[model samples]
Target chain A: MNPFKTIFGTSAVAAAALVAFGLTAAAPSAQAAEKTSFKLAWSIYVGWMPWGWAADNGIVDKWADKYGIDIEVVQFNDYIESINQYTAGAFDGVTATQMDTLGIPSVGGVDSTALLIGDFSNGNDALILKDGDSVEDVLGRDVHLVELSVSHYLLARALATLGKSERDVTVVNTSDADMIAAYQTDDVTAVVTWNPLVAEILSMPNATKVFDSSDIPGEIIDLTVVNSETLADNPAFGKALAGTWYETMGIMMSDTEAGRAARAAMGKASGTDLAGYDMQIASTKMFFDPAEAAAFGASEDLKTTMESVRTFLFDHGLLGDGAPSADVVGIEFADGTVMGDESNVNLRFTTRYMDMAADGAL
Target chain B: MTRLVNRHPDRPTRLLLAMLPFALLIAAYAIGSDMRLAENPNDKLLPSFTALGDAITRMAFTPDKRTGDYLLWVDTVASLTRIAGGVAIATVFGLLVGVSVGLLPYARATLGGFLSAVAMIPPLAILPILFILFGLGELSKFVLVFAGIGPFIARDIAMRVAELPTEQIVKAQTLGASTWQICTRVVLPQMWPRLMDSVRLSLGAAWLFLIAAEAVASQDGLGYRIFLVRRYLAMDVILPYVAWITLLAFSFDWLLRVLQARLFPWFAPEGASR
Candidate 1:
């Protein structure tokens, strides 16, 4: 064969192959219809473990299949990072606390809705005093806790119980990883922290649980928050999530062998044994019954709880720099009462899916 | 010295060359940030200059509403104090150990291999153990930076000692110099410059360990501030903090270079160039 002919033919073949490869690579987006698949991010917490358990136990799959959609469950080692991922649109939804959802996503400009009220911290978070029987003993001492966290909120509320404020004691910003270590130090006599850490610290002989989240119930609420635009586009996603959550809740609430097994699995996943997990669960007021959760969501008490949370967040400057007041991010409740700026509603608490779960409509 | 592309630029040209990359980086970031903001004004990953400027003013200039601390200055002072204290301890101990390891056969036999092994252990991996052992005070953070950086400095000094010409030691000995005389006059004098060079090389790692320790368990630090704001996707604050850290690191490296040049004008380590 002539050299020119062979060279030209080979080059032409290579170009065609490249074009074909390009077309194959570009085909997926060209045929992209409405997204049927979604990702849900969850982190390790006593309140959020059900989302993981549901995914692992095929509960997530069953519901997703029923709705003719695919749901992928992702676990983040960090609680805040999970919400950040959801805010960044890397995930469609996430397990988050009410204040966190409002402070981060709502104020940061991601319109989100609390899809399910997973649980509220009952005694999961606590303020403990070393060698002191009363919360008053923490007076004039530097209180160690993760600053601007729910522990800080608990401390503020705990202090309020004593008819005092943060001014009574200096709040030293210790990290969660170092909380136990800080407590072990002689100088560190008081600390405000959450469960697992609470469990560990309370195990020490002199440590007394002076106050906890239970003292202010429904204030530290955990929720499965979903992107509002995504939910509006795919109501099936909402139904599927509600189904998955309530189903998991039923089994988890039961004292049957299977329920115990699921609980044990969840405990193991969260780096604890059965008894250890149960202790944490004892501190968490899990909304096992959808009707109760829905009623709580619709109640006027929720608006009051949110008001306290928003005020706490705003006072701490956890809200974005642009926030002129606590009302920078609007939080609409099930009764249509907005807690913040009504013109810019971002975090909405709707009981629709919870109601459907209660009525067995999903 | 034997490599390809050996053409050297003058000092002003070198300075201009160094500035080019930074200028290009800033331009590229501005463009990307503008494009993202044009699409969505609420985008956080690359915030606009105005947002960053506002964040800087709030963090650096204004007193915090609750605490009344200038956030940036406090964080910087905290971080710098820890790093300076840690590195200072590292330097003194490093000089003593490195000289011994380099000059004494016993020190070489005892500590040379052990130090090499210690340096091999990843500092960040044992951070929890450090916190637990040191009890989460400033001591733990200091010890972490020391543990991370100490062994490497010692090893470098030891090697520099070994590299000392035998003739110089013998010459001093021939002149009836004592064992201490060779170390004080010949060995240590040479090692001082090398010690500075070794420290210059390790400052990057020193910063890494310092930042990691701070990130893990600090009340206030540059790294702590960066990590704390990360939860909110506060890129405006985070980016400025990062740039400030970079500036601090570069200043330290530059200061060491100036110090070395001023103190040892007659000396130049191998591979020293523009």
Candidate 2:
């Protein structure tokens, strides 16, 4: 017999006995089978810092306690691995991008709902050229990037704007950890990556930003997404996440001393100083105000933006094999409209929770 | 300490003993997998054998739709080629330096401590330097594996040569052997089995450097494929690839043992365990 089986069996029986005793000893609650625990995963990024900040400052616990639940926020070093773990059902929710949320989980047959559109990349993801003036100047140069990531998406978009396809330049698939050192070499002249690496590269002499995600606003969106089934089963999870986000965002974006301290904590969490984090947050078009985020979520602008994102994902074969069309995955907007295959829609943009937060109902 | 010696077990008993731990590990995994899947059928952490089999079939038998290549075979070929190339070069160079520093007093005094220091430096610390100096290509990966294990191999060989009996050198000298003959005919013959042993031990470190280099930057390799699928939580693929790597390494180790035993039978004592 496995050792874990023996231990887990005894403990499981003991826990079940304790739960039965507690239920009989206490009064019945309003709702039956209410889940009071969940796990949320987040990685280091400009927009997603609020999750870590809220967890560290007891804001997550505060919001979770309001709904009589416990929320544990986990941090992942690698961006893609967090999403993978979420898709594997190891996490109840995760901070992901519009592109990754579609390309990975949705394509992998895990239905996820975009509960909150945290922010979009204004100039966060950029294309930098060494000794080059414009994007067109990178015609024959080799481009280094974390392939199949948003940087790759940004590179394709930049190339399209330059009237050149991927064939125009050689792409060197590099890891994010090595991108900085790879660029330090004279051989790597062109690189498409996200900040703060972009900030670090730009600090070098003669480096120019040829293009950035800001050129196409509302395209690169960061979101806090949860499993569709998990959310539908427990509406409190969505409420707790939204409440925690807005509360943290409000404090971090304020002009108060407390806000500065909050921002400093966030900066330190992301391995940067206060000024560096402030600059990154400035580049990131964060939806700090709940009302603005609610309006943005409900607006038709979101639908149009997702249409472009879905098109990009499908065009790049990220929607999985035999997609038939760009509508391989259904995307629900805030206005009760669905794009792609409606019956099989997976990427949902729901504003009910955010709207409630904005209306001060939470 | 009390000497605890036992007679060698019979063939069947020895075989059972060898297979016991592996059998227990497999059984433990099978039970754990069943329990996890029973709780959650969608669990990807501990995939069932069928899932791993399916992943292996997909990677090894089928061609990827996008790339139109058998990824498992391609990765194996690429990884083996790099390991073979790196190990081959390291063996030749390690043997030369080891013999030179072992035989000549001047060479030993000048380079012995230097090579020891080189062996102490962590190879992964200089991975960025390798990439910067050699670019993110096969050359960088090859150089990383070579540099990572070469010093250790040389040091091991030098230690073996230093421990050689002084009587052998005196005998060779009294036989009117030239300095070159004394080094080659007398010393080189004795270092062959030891060199093979050093190479076998260094294979582990060589693989470590190869995987580190490949994981940092590479378009194709077993390490690259493992990391690429890791982003999807494809433990089915990752686990099977890991098993495959273990099998490949084991095969190489067994082959080297066989070669050593066949070519240098005199190195072993009769009725003694390996």
Best by TM-score: 1
Compose the digit string of candidate 1's lDDT tens values, residues B112-201.
Answer: 899889889997777666766786679988998899898889888888898888898889999999989988988988887788888888
Q: Tell me the lDDT of candidate 2.
A: 0.82
Off by over 4 Å in 2: A1-33, A162-164, A307-328, A341-345, B1-58, B269-274
Across A1-362, the per-residue lDDT of candidate 2 in tens digits comes to 43444554566556655543442332211133357788899999989988988898898999999988889999999888898878766677899998889877776656788899899999999999988888899898788887778888888888889778787887767888988888887778899999999999999887899999898887899999998877887899899999999988889889999999988888998899889999998888999887887788888888887777778777755665457999878888878788888888778888888888889989
Number of the top-ranking candidate, with DockQ as the measure: 2
Model 1 per-residue lDDT tens digits across residues A116-179: 9988999999999987888899888888887778888888888888899989998777778767
What lDDT is reached at residue B174 by model 1?
Answer: 96
Worst 10 residues of 2 chain B by lDDT: B1-10
Backbone atom clashes (below 3 Å) for every candidate: 1, 1
How far is each candidate from the true structure, as Cα RMSD in Å?
Answer: 6.1, 5.9
